[model samples]
Target: MTFGEKLQKLRKEAGLSQEEFADQMGVSRQAVSKWERDSGYPETEKIIRMGRIFHVTLDYLLNEGEGQSEDLAEGKNEEKGMYVSRETADGFLAFRQRKSLRTGLAWGLISGGLCLSIWWTEPGMILYLVLMIVSVVLLFSVKLADNPYRRIEKEPLVFDEQVKADLNAAFSERKKTAYLLRLTGIVLIAAGILICPLITTWVPLVDDIIFAAGLAAAGVGIFLCIYMTGILRAYRLLMRQETE
Candidate 1:
């Protein structure tokens, strides 16, 4: 008998329907159906699991049948668990890398533009307005970008230990840079807060040029912090800490 036929016979003898068998195997019912119909075969791991369920040896289930032992391990069918492939993981990282820059810039522009527009420069206000509009649009676009891994959000992801290790290493590589940018951002913000007020207190007059310049510097610092954080968040998503 073929592997599927043998599987069907074993499941029937055990008084299990396709759905029950699928549940026992930690797979979808359709996956069980495909197996029984010989349209698909389970992975080598799944085959081993099934052997245990039926109280049969791997040699017995796979014995001398069409030279199929090697072919059976090719997991062409999707399992119940979200088994994330390396390619998918890489694609997601690339997508996030591309999107996060735009996202960070958008937030930076919004904050900086609003702060710089405080002094109400006539022609400069026009420039800030354009930036603000563009920032808002970019933010929305990032939010609505097409995401292929959306379903992964609903389930716990399963991946090879190597994928996990690689992600951890990548995050480690990025953490130092992100930390520096965040520290710099804190310094710049502090300067922005104190730069104008300190001068104003001494002179009893404030310079719009100085205040706007300080806020603008703070904005560039904000951009760096946001950009670095956004990149790290992508690593977190793949690591399965939390979803987006």
Candidate 2:
């Protein structure tokens, strides 16, 4: 019995084909097969890695006749160390921070623009309507930035054992909150649009007052939506830091 026989026995006992074992070892299937067939031997480093992957001692992997526990723990610490690396944690933190800053700046710009439009325009109602539409658009932009489509591609493949579950839970909560906020905004905007004709047509003594109050309520709702979005963004950023 030789190293090749030992390698084949470990692979079979672990329920892995040559290709599957090669992938875990980060080597080619042909390389695994060659090792198993006595055509070649893995380098010292790869042999150690194979031992870890198979949960066997180096002695058992090198000598066919040796027996050892297959439940030996090895790769867990390596995986955890990779996940908690400073660089990876820093990258996620930077991404979340930038997103929060961008959302806050967008809200400020929107609020200032609406104020200016109200002051400068002669028909303030029309300007207010335009501002409502613009605010809705900006909210959509914030949502998009928070979960950029490209992030699915760019996110780190490695996940920290301690942080992985927490990150997933936070993400789920944020998504639910965002959906509710968006739904509320959409409903308010639709109601406002339906009331536009009535506000324009009614000629009661208090029609002007009623119209002004409606516009003010709509404005407040829109602003509230923006404020809630900012809060959610900040919460997400803080969660990211906690995970790190």
Candidate 3:
């Protein structure tokens, strides 16, 4: 394919119009049009910039013998599913991270409210109610409207071997950290629940304080577990999609 043809293909695949791409290249629309027509050639610097912009090698753009008719993003089709691209996979992971954080925070706030309500009675009850309401809002805020990869949730996905391998490698390290967090969270929850009974006898009339502190620890533990589990599951979900 000609440089013009390749340039046009890259720009379109990236969902950029002539004017938009021209702006990114710091050139006029007419200049971009001329380049796509093969009447004008960009300088070496611009060509290099183009390679970076399209996530392709210089050979793919400069050499005519390079992967002709086989574009970098060849739109790999699967038997009965959509081909999940690298861009899509990365975007999905980022989206899941944000979602998990919001979800974890919501659960944490609700759990923490239980301790708060016990600590101060009337005022605590009001704050607890406020927390509950805030938690609900946080949970509801995790919507798919802004997520570009929302379709991945419903569609069967296909992946290249390399992508799956990379994800697994990263997940190996991630899993260890996640497990550590999960363990620490479990310990905190257990300690919080045990604190009341263990300290009640020694600290007379301090039932409220003991229970409040215990519940607070439990809340933090719950948050850690929920957050870690969420991210852990999200990575697995991607791997499973590749497997199935």
Candidate 4:
């Protein structure tokens, strides 16, 4: 029999309707329907759990016509637990990466513009302003992209352990840089605060320029800290700590 036929047959022999089976499987009724209709594949984690529920081996579930009738009767049913599909996990990872990239690009453009503006005179400032506007538009466009797994927000996510570990390592390195960026930002802002009043009294024209540059530095620094914290939050979610 096809996997769907087998699934339906097993549910019937167990005296459970589709809705009851869905509850037992920790999935929505619609998700169960989709599975039994052969419209979708469950995440690998769910497939493993299903074998435990039905007293069948992974070979039986994945391969065709491999299990005995007594298998279901011999199985032990565990309490249902939350899960996210592999597709959802992948989509979320992409989303987080895109967000981080957008943030970095935006900050880079703004900082570069401000730094060059201080030395390049009026034309340099104008060019940087144009780049800043373009960056803003790109940021908005990234945010407007459709989310592939909106429903993942409602349930506990089940991501691969290796993927989470990789994310941890990558973000940990980023955290070091984020800390340094924030420190640099604070120093720039403090220097501006100290110099602005004194320079305004003695060199008013350059005071405004230095103060503007300091403000840009501080803003970029704050964003770096915020972005790093956001990455950490996504890492926690991937590790399923959000459920805890």
Candidate 5:
């Protein structure tokens, strides 16, 4: 079918008049009419917007046969939380990698600065040990944060009941993970604070170590909380899309 035919079909399916569709697309009615008549094409960005608005692929709007294959594949993968194409997966992966790298660097700086501060005051071996533990936890967060879209893609979308339940379960699990990490950090901090005075009397080195460990734990905990919160928000958006 021609692009015009596809445009009309989608517009009708959406139960939108030309004026209404134009309003939704933020374009003039004449522009929508032109598109429906195949007199002109939308700009690249508008094409993407139209595809999303119509629940169709760009290829389909462009009259490319590949869109049918993609649509079929997308339908199958909807239940599996996968994308229709490798390009989509790769694009998401690249975005996640960039975000993860930035997060890792930021955490590294904070953790490094804390360790350096402690070391400067005194040569405390325990400070290094505590930083090491914190580093490990941050590493885990980095790994998990890198692919925040994984759960969204893997969720089943067949029945509304099942889909809603799965989304809720995933969101709750994410929240639980964040809470546990934060609780662990708080406990470590309290323990360190209580032990600091005792360690100071025993040896200066012990005091510094305890202080460094506490700071590291707190820093990592804060980072995890922020990271998980962002993921939860993203999941909400995905759920919205699924429902829409």
Candidate 6:
């Protein structure tokens, strides 16, 4: 047995065609084919990546024989259905953080602009509208950070044990933060809704202004709740995959 043979076996066991495997590893099908044919060797980085993808160690990939091959074969028969990658988990974490920041900023800007627009004359309203447009543009920027891996949506490749533990810890902390954001948003929205009817009774002279302020708070709160929930759901899916 050889490294090429092991790679071929692992790829087959994973139920991926050469093309699909190459796509996952960010390589060409021809490159994978060449490796499997023993005509070319993968670079060190690729070798490491292959180790991760196949859930094997460097030694396992480097040393090969019938015994080791048979061991892997038996392992595969157990049919571990899916996997997750440390790289993918980290990437998802960063993406979610960036997106969360942008979402918060956008919501704050738009809501503030809306509140101001409510009180402004024509020219002032135009300025507030511009501010709101800027907020919308910020929201669009979320697409700028494109995900490079398939693991965020689907199951991920196998990660080293330590890497898996770290990812889980990080995700747990993030989940807590997400929950806090959700709670705060809910409280803000509840307060805003409750304050709406009270504005007239509490301060009749500035009823319209107070009402508009409440509306703005509620709008911001709604955006926060929606955005945070989306982030939480994505993390939850990954956690579920880890368990599976």
Using lDDT as the measure, the top candidate is 3
Model 5, range 1-244, lDDT digits (tens) per residue? 7777778877896566887567545578899899888898889977765665555656667754434867734533434322222223234334554564456445643654474576754555556556666666766776666343443355432223544566567667776775676566456545544553345546677767777766666555545544544555555554554532
TM-score list, all predictions: 0.61, 0.36, 0.63, 0.54, 0.42, 0.65
Q: Tell me the lDDT of candidate 3.
A: 0.75
* Per-model lDDT: 0.70, 0.55, 0.75, 0.61, 0.57, 0.71
Per-residue CA lDDT of model 3 for 1-244, tens digit only, reads: 7889889987897676887566556678899999999999999978865765565667778876545435454322213354455555776787788888888889988886788866566887788899999999988888533655544666566665776678889899899999999899889888988755477556545877888888888889889988999889878877776635
lDDT of 1 at 86: 56
Ordered by TM-score, highest first, the candidates read: 6, 3, 1, 4, 5, 2
Instruction: List where candidate 6 sits over 4 angstroms from the true fold.
Output: 1-49, 55-60, 63-85, 107-112, 143-145, 201-205
| Native-referenced Cα lDDT, model 6 | 0.71
Please report the TM-score between candidate 1 and the true structure.
0.61
Q: Which has the higher TM-score value, candidate number 2 or candidate number 4?
A: 4
In the range 136-177, model 4's lDDT, one tens digit per residue, is 986787788765444454545433456446656766776677
Backbone clashes in model 5, listed as residue pairs:
81-153, 81-154, 127-209
- Predicted structure 2: lDDT: 0.55
Question: Candidate 5: lDDT over CA atoms?
Answer: 0.57
Give the higher-lDDT candidate: 1 or 2. 1
Q: List where candidate 5 sits over 4 angstroms from the true fold.
A: 4-101, 121-165, 189-199, 239-244
Model 6: how far residue 15 lies from native, Å? 11
**Per-residue lDDT of 157-185 in model 1, one digit per residue for the tens?**
66657766787898898888888887897
Q: Please give the range of 10 consecutive residues that has the lowest summed lDDT in model 6.
A: 76-85
Q: How many backbone clashes does candidate 3 have?
A: 0
Which pairs of residues have clashing backbones in candidate 2? none
